[model samples]
Structures are given as structure tokens and as C-alpha cells.
Target: MRQSLLALLAKEPAHGYELKQALEAIFGSAYPSPNIGQIYVTLGRLEKDGHVRSVGVEQSNRPNKKVYYITAAGLETLQAWAEEPTEGPRVRDEFFMKLVLAPMTGLSDRMALINRQRRHYLSLMRELGELAERTDPGDRVALLLIEGAMLHLQADLDWLERCQEELP
Candidate 1:
């Protein structure tokens, strides 16, 4: 959230509401929108950290608004963040932890665990598929995000099947 706001401020100075609107416009409804309070809190933190500077903008009939602009340090941070590669997928995840620990914990029902996770993944895939169908064809970004989720779910289901085979 901090870096996103910094990037937006780098483009131009904006108040918290404007930044929030920009984020929603970019991500669409695919992501849960950040609350106004969250944006303000982030801005406050950024100001304290010297990543952003805020100035009071007075209006005749409305309350004074604090407009934020990104600093040079913020731009450097944003640039570094843009260049950094994201971490790869985790090999030892929550599901794997449960699968390995179940026997020692005396549950000893790996198949049940795998089946339950598989069902959950399939349900998510179905929901995402429906969303994809409802999404406008011209909105390529949303479509791509939905398709990517579906693909990940499919991979998860396949991994569950492998777990079932190997554990049994």
C-alpha cells in the first residue's frame, strides 16, 4: 500500500481520496478496495518517514485538505521496488505442514485433508470461472487475473491428487 501510494504520488500530487480512486480505477473490482482511513494512515506514515510531503490546500466552503507529493527518496524506493523480483512459490506451505503433522498428531487422515483442500480449490475455480464469464471481454486485465487464478487453482488440485497418491 505504501509503495503503491508513493508511485501514484510520483505521478502527481493528490489527496487521500484521489489516491484511493486511482487505485480502484487501476485494479478494478478484482482487489478489495482500501478504506479511506487506511490510505490516510499510510500517508501519515509516509510523511513521517520522509517518503512524502503534505501541504494544506484550503477551499472556500470545504475543509482544508492535505495534498501529498512524493519525495526524491520515495522515487528511489519506488524504482527499486519496481526492479525487484517477487519471491517464488512456497514449497513448504500451510497445507504441506498439515499433511506432514497430521500423523504425529494422531489424526492420520491425510486423504481426508487432501480431499477437503481439493474441494475448496475446485469451488474457487468454479466461482472464478463464473466471474470470468460475467466479465466484459474488452476488459482484458480482469479476464487475465481471473484466468490466472483458475490456473493456480487447477495446479493446486493437481498437487492434492499427487498428495493422495503418494500418502496412500
Candidate 2:
């Protein structure tokens, strides 16, 4: 979230609300709308870390709003972050833990667990498919994010099948 805000500041100086709006515009419904207070807290941390700086812009009838700008260090940090590759999918997933431990814990309901998760994945895929269809065709980024999520969910469903075949 820090890097994301910094990248926005790199484009232009903006107040917290503007930054929040920019994020929403970028990610659309896919990005959970960040709380205004969370934005302020991140901005405060960025300023304290010297990655960003804020100036108070006063209004005649309202309280001053702090507008944030990316400092040189912030720009460098953002660049580094952009270049870094994201981590791949996690191997030790929570569901896998539960699947392995449930028998020992006397659940012994692997089929039930697998069926429940399969239903969940199918439901999410349907939702994501709907979201992709509703998304603007021009917004390639948003479409790709949705596509990626749908693909991940499909992978999870496939893994569940493999588990069903291998496990008693």
C-alpha cells in the first residue's frame, strides 16, 4: 500500500482523498476502497520515513488539508519496488493444513471439506467472470487482474481434484 500511494504521488501531488479516488479509479471494484483514515496513516508514515512530504493547503471556510508529494527517496523506492518481482503462490496454504490435520483432529470429513471448497471456488469464479464482463474493455489492467484471479481459483479447484484422487 505504501508503494502504491508513492507511485500515485510520483504522478502528481494529491490530498488523501484524491489518492484514494485515484486508487479506486485504477482498480475499480477489484481494489477494496481504502479507508480515509488508512490513507492518512500511510501518508503520515511515508512522511516520517522521508519518502514523502506533506504541505497544508488551507481553505477559506474549511480546515486545512494536507497534500502529499513524493520526495526523491520516495521515487527511488517506488522504482525499486516496481522492478522487484512479486512472490509466487504460497505452498503451505491454510486449507492444505486443515485437510492434512482434520483426520487426526477427528473431523475425518475430507470429502465434505473438499466439496465445500469446490463450491466456494466455483462461486468465486462465477463472480469474477461477471466482474470481468462488466468491466470496461478499455481497462486492460482491471480485466487482467480479474482474469488472473479466476485462473488462480481454477487452479485451486484442480488441486482439490488431485487431493480427492490421492487422499483416502
Candidate 3:
């Protein structure tokens, strides 16, 4: 959620509700989106630390909201976070968990599962490539991240193929 907040705040100042909507848009329908309460909590934390500020009021017929603008300090912190190296992306793969139990099931089942993952990864690579093509050339960081994703997926696919070939 921190990542989502950081990315949205980087673009422009937004109210908590606006940030929630933007996050849903980027994530699409695959996962459950963050709640408005969560968004407000994050904004509160940022504000308390002086990383964000309540810039102005956004009046509406329905509900009036306070919009937040990221401070210069916030930008610096975000930039530093973006540039920092991590121990790879933090994610949980159900497929990897399934693979760990594959030997107990059967070699054929394991091979089939690996092939399915390979196909899925290949499809993801194609989608990422298409997205890259549509993105502006000036977005070097985005481009580099996309390329890195493709390479990572390719490596996984290759390993799956090798495993399939070696197994009975």
C-alpha cells in the first residue's frame, strides 16, 4: 500500500478518495482494491511527518474532501526509495508453493504445472512488451523496469522448460 501511495503522490496532489480510485485503476480487476480508510490513514501518517500537507479543500455536492500535496521532502524520500536496491520484489507466488509440493503429487502433474506457468509468464511478457511500446520513450525508469520484468519472466520460463526436459 505504501508503494501505491508513493506512486500516486508522485504524479500529483490528490485527495484520499482520488488516490483510492487511481490505485484501483492501475491494479485493474485482478485484486481487491484498498479502502478509503486505508488511504486516509496513510495520508494522516504522511502529514504527521511533514512529508505531505493538506493543500486545499475540494468541495463537492456529495462529500467535501481535503486534498493533499506532497512536499519537496516527500519527493526526495520517494526518489530515494525508488533508487534503493531491495532483495528482489516482495511477492507471494501460489504457483511456487504448489511446485514445492509437486514431487508428492507426481512428476507428470509437476511438468504440466510448470508448462502452465511458462505459458502464463510468456503471456505476461507479451502484455508488458505491448505496454512498453505504448509508454513514452522519456520514461526510462519505467522502460528499464519493464525490460527487467521481461528478463525475469524469461528466466523462469527457461528454467521450467529445462526441468520439463530433464524430468521423466
Top candidate by TM-score: 1
Per lDDT, the best of the predicted structures is 2
Error of 1 at 89 (Å): 3.6
What TM-score against the true fold does each predicted structure earn? Answer: 0.93, 0.89, 0.53
TM-score of 3: 0.53
Candidate lDDT (C-alpha), each: 0.88, 0.90, 0.77
Model 1 TM: 0.93
RMSD of 1: 1.5
Per-residue lDDT tens digits for candidate 3, residues 1-168, read 765686688798888888988877765543467888978898898888878888667567765678888888888888888899867754336666777677786663777788788878889988999988987787666677778878887777776777677765
Residue 19 Cα positional deviation in candidate 3, in Å, after optimal superposition: 7.5
Model with the higher lDDT, candidate 1 or 3: 1
Sorting all predicted structures by lDDT, with the top scorer first, yields 2, 1, 3
Q: Which stretches of candidate 2 lie above 4 Å from their native place?
A: none
Residue 35 CA displacement from its true place in model 3, Å? 8.6
Tens digits of per-residue lDDT for model 1, 1-168: 998999899999999999999999988867788899999999999999999999999999999999999998989999999999978666538889999889779876887788788788888888998898898888777888888878777788788888888885
